[model samples]
Target: MQGVPEEWTEEDGGTGERSRGTGTGKGEETMMMELTRLVQKTVKESSWWERRGIDCSILAAAFISLPPAFLLLGSSHFLWFSAGVLLMGVAHGIITIKGTHLASHGALSESQAWAKFWAVFFIEICGSFSALAGVKGHIKMHHAHTNVIGLGDSSVWKVPFLSRSIYLFIAPLAVPVITPLVALGRKYFPVERDNRTVAMVTLGLYSQYWLLINVSGFTSPLSALLCMLVCRAMFSVPYIHVNIFQHIGLPMFSPTRRPKRIYQMTHGVLNLPRNPLLDWMFGHSLINCHVEHHLFPFLSDNMCLKVKPVVSKYLTEKQLPYQEDGYLSRLQLFFNRYQELMVFAPPITELVGVQ
Candidate 1:
């Protein structure tokens, strides 16, 4: 943990995701409130098409994975298969980072079991993570303590002197490789049920990978393993980078800190509206509609994009934060704030008020 601070409280309970009327930004007054309302209005009025777009992306991600799987079945060309797997793997990474991550937070829907299963399928089955263990660490630990050292996933494998700009690019490539080791290492050393799942899932994934490649006659057993490892390594780079963009470089608060939910979210996290074509392909899960996703996880990526403005308006009327930095601006911030941004910090422990 980086460091715990004081705490905040409103009439309802303590610091939480919801607003209870009383808050610290009471001083920013009217203008901020108007912005919040505007944002919310925009979110509310979002069109059906936008929502559909998100869904398309999700399906597209899955679609992209199929060809490579098919390729391994027929061809033994390691390079060709590696390239295809690398692409689809990236798709899985996007869905996991975006869809599964939100779903795990119960942000998707109330169907706890469905969310749980989706989380496992996306992260463990595809993106290479243990669903339960990832949640325990992500929802319970990381989200609970955004940038607190040793808590947040963002901070987990950061290395000093690694440039923030490059780090974002590098992390995706690292995740498929590093995250698994971390999961397996923890299980190997101390042992945890989720960790055991890690063992099981890893075995399953590799077995499937090997069986597919070999049965496909794409390569000899030796060659298939080599190709799989290479694809995973190449794929990890961008997957990690995309994950980093979703949340990092925003104002972090201790448990005591009372930043408006809107501000905390907008500034706290990022929205990279990049690769419109790819966004059409995998952008939904790559940080697009992020604010809406956080606000309403289950609202298909399509729904979130449409309602983003409406939500923004409501948040605006409430005089909350509504940040949407340009892609370049965010990239710069990551470069400037990588270390602190990646590390997790503990919540503040202060007065309990209607913050």
Candidate 2:
């Protein structure tokens, strides 16, 4: 495969290579280089505190809030218990979406050992998914080959036979129940497995159940189980929606025609409207800062947001695609054109003309 630029081939850094280009030639390279310089400048200007503080606060929130929420579940008042469940659900979502995501990318800590430790903790223990599997499926596959069929495609959620209503509405509610089963099944496949990750995940999940039953004062095992399911469901719906929304309707590519980094990400990824709630819970990589995240996958979410203006402006000035759509607009597109957008294979575009 040809390099994006001679100096910065994916093979040189193990970042993964683009298999093809859009044929825009030197002009494309010039635009990409300018964007790269801007990103480097932004990185240098960023403070150490800015780089690390948001992640620390997010981690603290996930750890500190869960125990109190669990204790509140023991309250006799219905309102109190309900409040506890809501808080617990929100905290767990942050752990899964933001905390585990950062750790999986090794963005949470500089040390590989510490990064792996927290990745396992947040993903397996709190998120009820396999850390090793996530690193393989998400980081290795999805990020390396975004929107490429049989690789980065988000086809897990695609169900062709289901009626649009059921597929869009009712199916998302089951994501919480389905995610762990999928994770477990992936473990049995020929993919890489970490014995420590499996053991830790097993222990963490069971311990959580035990705490919910005994310490949380749940009246019965069934009640504890129900609480767990409900809390996970709160995150699952939006999680499923966001995963599909960001890339499903965008341009896809055959592996042979995968464009260079900037072209591939800008063409394939999208940014949704700003939502303060999701920004905090899901982090910038998965929200309005998505394009920036793709361009700088290793940057922490805080840094991604900080550099967004430079990235966005450069893309716009160059007249390259910088896709953004409202959350509802995406939903409407998904509903109205479910077949073309989700069920059927996405159409791949070749950039044929240039300045």
Give each prediction's root-mean-square deviation over alpha carbons.
7.3, 4.2
Q: Cα miss at 254, model 2 (Å)?
A: 1.5
* Global fold similarity of model 1 (TM-score): 0.67
Which whole-number lDDT from 0 to 100 does residue 60 have in model 1?
A: 58
Q: lDDT tens string, model 2, 47-124?
A: 877787777788797779988899988899999999999998898888878988887777777666677777778788
Given candidate 1, what's the lDDT at residue 64?
A: 63
For residues 141-168, could you state the per-residue lDDT of candidate 1 as single tens digits?
Answer: 5444443334443655556566665566
Candidate 1 ranges with C-alpha deviation above 4 Å: 1-57, 60-69, 72-87, 94-99, 106-110, 145-153, 161-172, 187-192, 218-222, 233-235, 260-263, 277-286, 316-319, 336-355
lDDT per model vs. reference: 0.52, 0.77
Q: Give per-residue lDDT, candidate 1, residue 308.
A: 61
